[model samples]
Target: MKRKATAVWKGAGKTGKGTLSTQSGVLKDSNYGFSSRFEDGEGTNPEELVGAAHAGCFSMKLAFVLQENDFEAEEINTESQVILEDGAIKEVFLITKVKVAGLENDKFTEMVNDAKDNCPISKLLDAKINLEAELL
Candidate 1:
């Protein structure tokens, strides 16, 4: 139940660059720097990675919740927006588009909210998290 990623940085703050590598080898020595994080640059950033993780976690949780309720999801798409302000993560906005058969809108909304609240990543974040779910 443990995962790890390593970051190696060189030089000083503003111009310093780093490489991020994960245990899974999906991101082996991926580069990141100040411009990539704060401005438009050609590399991956921490916030983008966080957003991807959040989206993946929320979607999987929603799928599990539906299955536990005797339902199955046809498809689930999620987008997470990570907002940083004053050098701190302020909020995360989760937008979901779901497709399920034989499920009421109210029930879907309820499950979406439950997933948002119960997802491990969501629970770990100490910031405002909002969900906008669309049932299709």
Candidate 2:
């Protein structure tokens, strides 16, 4: 399956404004500009979107990994931090909190590591990946 999003930009780099649209329409003609990406602004940016996608994908992968190990999680919250350095993405840090019943620490850690290494998004990223998992 393939998903697509389109971005349209006009004018010069610093002064140009852009709109990003996704196939699902969640970002239909959403605003993105230099201020939005480089400075604090109300518009959306690519790094923010990447963080959201990474977090969502990691959470889902963690859930599946837990279930596969016979340890169903009650809640899984993941936060992905993408760091950009020298105009390129440098690292992706995943901080996850999981609430599961009847799962030991060692086993849970193993599963979390497996999910971090095997998740599709994680595999796709060339940046360094860091994960922190906790059971609550």
Candidate 3:
């Protein structure tokens, strides 16, 4: 499987602006720039996009893992915090609250850990992965 996104930037680094377009069209021509990325600006940024992807990816992976264990998640809410420090992504913190019936807390924690460790984005990121999971 393959996916692609395009970025177009013009002018100087600090003052320049850019637009990001994804093949899926979900993020077509989204605005991004130095202000939007490093400061509060009316646009999206790379870290925000990465956080969304990580959250979505982790959720889906957990669903599949639960299915494999003969269980199903009633709901899985995951929030990813991509910590950027020293101009690099130092860590990804995955905070999740799951609602699954008839699943032991220990088993659920195991599955959550597995999903956090094995999710595609998680595997791709060369940074520390921290998780806070609640089996509600």
**What is the C-alpha local distance difference test score of each model?**
0.96, 0.91, 0.95
lDDT of 1 by residue, 1-136 (tens): 9999999999998899999999999999999999999999989999999999999999999999999999999999999999999988899999999989999999998999999999999998988999999999
Say which prediction, candidate 1 or candidate 3, comes out ahead on lDDT.
1
Residue-by-residue lDDT tens digits, candidate 2, 68-134: 8777888999999989889998899999999999999999899989999988988888899999889
Misplaced by over 4 Å in model 3 are none
TM-score winner between candidates 2 and 3: 3
- The total of clashing pairs for model 3 equals 0
Question: How much is 54 displaced in model 1, in angstroms?
Answer: 0.4
lDDT agreement of model 2 with the native: 0.91
The model with the greater lDDT, 2 or 3, is 3
- Candidates sorted by TM-score, best first: 1, 3, 2
